[model samples]
Target: MDASASPAAAAPDPASTPGPGPVPPPAPVSRLRRLAVPVGAMAAAVAAFGYVAAVDPNEPGHYPVCPMLRFTGLLCPGCGGLRSAHAFAHGDLATALGSNALAVVGYVVLAVVWLLWTVRASRGRPLRIGVAPVYWWGIGAVLLVFSVVRNLPFGSALAP
Candidate 1:
């Protein structure tokens, strides 16, 4: 009747217990598999740039007019983006900046982000582009200001 002699006090044998076995490590990723997404994305981007570089957007009909500009005479943030890309692709940085400074900044930002993504993908790591909602709103606000300024007489230099 001693508490120390109770059957319930004995520990169960781990070998006798049914449980999940040790987990296997994840399979190694092949180099091609690891780099596939980034390389494909870069290829698509290069193709698009090549097309834009060859076909001029300044010719008016080559690209569609911005509806905002066409309808209301108001320039939207992306009004001259194609022209900017064309200028950028041809290495005319000044014309690119004149066409759309924001678009030039966008190209730089895309390049930086793509570089980071490519590097992370090559290393077999997930690309993390977690921008906060506030930052996105801030970017929108900046674009709006840029659009408004470029349309005004004082900011004519920003107009395409």
Candidate 2:
């Protein structure tokens, strides 16, 4: 060492030097931040369902009439969905099915999907949903058939 060199003037430690590998940058958000959107959406949906449950649509004037049915005097597939939800909320399965069988099925599907969504969100995984075009067309076809059937005299029992 030089006579004038002090302890602070020594060669830099190899451990303190930059390494050969590229450094990974810090994440823009923590794990909790990534979960916020999904959690919020789930909460909103639950609140909406709670509101629908609390406001029973079975009472004739509680909810607005379905415009399509009012104008056409024909039952659309969704004609009695609100009532169905009301029935479902009250634990009246028969009334729910009577009001709207499709709505009951939709409720079940929504519940299942929501459960999966919550699980995926908690696990910090991206949600994935892919409804093929054919499936969408099939849904449309089913709705069309339901509308037609509900309006026919033979299917009067299915009418809302």
Candidate 3:
């Protein structure tokens, strides 16, 4: 050590130290407040399904034609989604699948995700979907395949 270096210089300054002040605790979260989002979302979905159930999508001009089906003469992945939802809302699983299996699957998935979200929120924990990039790519690939297959002669059953 250098002789010029002083021990006082190495010492921590008391003036710079933080005081023992009382810090207030965070406000307690209410259960209703935590559950509000999930409940509202569920209500919105139920209302939408109820609307679709009341309206007949199978009837011509009741709903807008699929843009891809109109322009390209090709069945898009979501071509029969509305019809599927209508059938599903009416408790006709067979017709729902016949209209659009993917949409039916989507409805089921959404319900499951919503249920999970509700459960987590009730416990004051935030739910996260950390799906890998590969999973997203796989989903895209499935949609592309469904679109292509539903338009083919062999896949006429999948058509809307």
Q: Give each model's whole-structure lDDT.
A: 0.91, 0.83, 0.93
Q: Give the lDDT ranking, best first.
A: 3, 1, 2
TM-score winner, 2 or 3: 3
Q: Any residue pairs clashing in model 3, and if so which?
A: none
> What would the per-residue lDDT of candidate 2 be over residues 51-82, giving only the tens digit for each residue?
88998776777788888878988888998888
Model 1 lDDT on a 0 to 1 scale: 0.91
TM-score, candidate 2, is 0.76
**How far out, in Å, is residue 130 in model 3?**
0.2
Comparison by lDDT, 2 against 3, better one: 3
Error of 3 at 132 (Å): 0.5
For model 3, the local distance difference test gives 0.93
Question: What TM-score does candidate 1 get on C-alpha atoms?
Answer: 0.84
Give the winner by lDDT: 3
Q: By TM-score, is 1 or 2 better?
A: 1
Tens-place lDDT digits, model 3, residues 48-123: 9999899999889888898889999999999899999999998999999999999999999999999999999999
- What TM-score would each prediction reach against the true structure? 0.84, 0.76, 0.87
